[model samples]
Target: MSQAGAKRKLQLSELEELRNDAYASARIYKARTKVFHDKHIVRKSIEPGNKVWLFNSKLKLFPGKLRSRWNSPYQVQTVTPHGAITIFDPKKGKTLQVNGQRLKQYIKDSVPTEGVESVTLADPIYST
Candidate 1:
């Protein structure tokens, strides 16, 4: 009976050691995955008065092969250091705050034809 009890004690200790090793393996895997995810993240910087396009992820549920998923340009109202930004929609006269990562700078092309000038990024210049 004493020998059988000793064997049970040894098996319990081995099981505990196996559990500890599994816990350590899970921790190491989590750390490595976090590092990999952080490395691929792209940082976006925006300033007030800049025009940006907002990504519209809600359109994914619908089927539109040629339709764009990004919304129209919105003017930046304010930017925060914690990657949050406030934007204003001129058409709706409404303001919205969103994550800076979801916004991308909008560049408009200016083509001048028939003595009329196009819109510029900084300011508009009229032709006489």
Candidate 2:
């Protein structure tokens, strides 16, 4: 019947409209989430002569969770303009170029007694 055909077309249009709305909402949500993530990201500033740790990404198959993935105390030798970093390993006396994203600044621990203070606690009296 003509009425049945009209009803089917209306239902199809409504379904198409719902799909379009869902797609638009998804795009908006993704854009907002990206902005929020970008805002919270801390930028790493690495310079020459600063000590940094290198992240090893090669161990993928059987990487032990307890083992540290970062190789520490590598001195930064040079920083290229295109974000490439050259680091020197004192133990091996070798220099290698790597991506800047894999490096994080290494902060040396200060003297153990510098910020530590002795604390004294009094015994509590028991009351019935």
Candidate 3:
């Protein structure tokens, strides 16, 4: 084959296949390392069934369990497309409608772990 012929050898289908493979790999990676701040995670509009941390405005209503930064992770059951998300509260065993802006995605460290914050690394040493 001539040099010019070889230069244009790649078919359009090959290019599309490569793109699809890349997309699939990225989806898998996202599903695995979903460890990031809420802002980054919930950026491109959220969908129902996605897990998110419901923020607590009132300190009194907030659980005194352990993680005390300001968040409670809950599974989303409904999304309002532009307004709200209905979250399922495992503790209450019921779903509650809440505004999206008040929610945060849960993170393990650098923020606080769920209910395990108070019983921290220091507890092992100072236990009575």
**What tens digits encode model 1's per-residue C-alpha lDDT throughout 1-128?**
99999999999999999999999999999999999999999987789999999999899899499999889999999999998999999999999999988899998976656788676689776899
What clash pairs does model 3 have? Answer: none
Ranked by lDDT from best down, the candidates are 1, 2, 3
Off by over 4 Å in 1: 110-128
Best by lDDT: 1
- Tens-digit lDDT string for candidate 2 (66-112): 88888868999999887899999999999999999899989887668
User: Backbone clashes in each candidate structure, one number apiece?
Assistant: 0, 0, 0
Candidate 2 global TM-score? 0.58
Misplaced by over 4 Å in model 3 are 1-44, 60-69, 107-128
Residue 30, model 1: lDDT of 100
For residues 9-123, what per-residue lDDT tens digits would candidate 3 score against the true structure? 6665688899999999999889767755433754535577777876567766655777575556788888886667888978778889988887766545685566664544554
Best by TM-score: 1
Query: What lDDT score belongs to each candidate, Candidate 1 first?
Result: 0.93, 0.91, 0.73
lDDT of 3: 0.73
